[model samples]
Target: MNRLDNPILQVLESYKAAVWAKDVNALVALYDRDAVVFDMWGTWSYNGIASWRAMVEGWFGSLGTERVIVDFSEARTIVAADLAVVHAFATYKAVDADGLELRAMDNRLTMTLRQQADGWNIVHQHTSSPIEAGTAQVIFRR
Candidate 1:
């Protein structure tokens, strides 16, 4: 199937749109009710949809006057009959209400999705960034 017609890609597009809008409900709707997430910041892991939703809410809430723009590159997806795994390098840029860039960071993202009756739902997600050997600080650039 063409990339443009891939359901997995559609999910990613939806995710980008949701994040850009800071729509917490729309963002969490992409995941399964029992999803697990290992986010790169703030906490070790989120155990379920509720936990993940809380984190997303906090994140969107904290933005206040800023909105995040998400971009994905080098995305690779493997799909079986009912399961799929996708990994990509994701960049997030925070922009002011006027759309001026504030700051940006890059991270690695991986998600495992299951085909549900309605559509593909992310069952597991993990995001991380490399640490510099000397400074032990996160490397946010490609």
Candidate 2:
């Protein structure tokens, strides 16, 4: 079956929607209360939902008059009973209030989720980009 057809992957859709709208509450709702996140920017790690929410708030707040569009490609998922792991190439495009694209970046994203009473909730999330071998600068695009 296609990965998109799987119910467990629905969180990804919610994630994209939340980010595009800069809806911090909806985005944080996709994670477990005890979720842990290793974001690609700024901090090294976020230990729980409270910490993750703060990061999300700051990210959306920093956008100002710009909005971010998030897209996921080359997504793959493995499901084993009540646990699932998903990895994908994620692209983020920044657009102005008028919808003109300003900048974009791509990164690798991996999320581990657990099937809960409500639905799949991410327990852990990690996002990263490759580094230049010599300069140690991040490679935003493949």
Candidate 3:
């Protein structure tokens, strides 16, 4: 099926909406109860929804609305039976109230989803930003 028409693709749209709206409640609702996340900044991936909630809440609390902007592009999805994988390049920016950009990062993201009775539920997510070759520093997609 085309990506746009796929109900599975709603997972990403919901994610974009939740992040842009900075609504943690909305964010977790898209995930499976036991989802794991390969986050950009952390000792390791989050174990489940509870851990995920704490981290996301911290992020929204710290950044608020003015600082965080997220955009996703080049999204593609593959579905087979009860499994689905959606991936895209995401650009996110953090700006101060003065409109000064503190940081910006573009990263590739992949989410693994399972078709449940309700809908597709995200079970795992992995995100990685390209490193600058010259400086050997990560762009810090968070």
Query: What Cα-based lDDT does every candidate model obtain?
Result: 0.94, 0.92, 0.85
Query: What digit string (tens of lDDT, one per residue) describes model 3 on residues 40-77?
Result: 88648898899999998998898755656777788888
Instruction: List the candidate 3 regions with Cα displacement exceeding 4 Å.
Output: 1-4, 65-67, 95-102, 140-142
* lDDT of candidate 1 at residue 31, scale 0 to 100: 98
Best by lDDT: 1
lDDT for model 1 comes to 0.94
Error of 2 at 69 (Å): 0.6
Kindly indicate the candidate among 1 and 3 with the higher TM-score. 1
Q: Write the per-residue lDDT of candidate 1 for residues 32-58, one digit (tens) a residue.
A: 999999998878989989999999999
- Put down candidate 2 lDDT per residue, 1-142, tens digits, no spaces: 6646887667888999999889999999999999999998879999999999999999999999999998889888999999999999999999998999999999999999999998999999999999999999999987
Each prediction's TM-score against the native?
A: 0.96, 0.96, 0.85
Query: In model 2, which regions exceed 4 Å deviation?
Result: 2-4
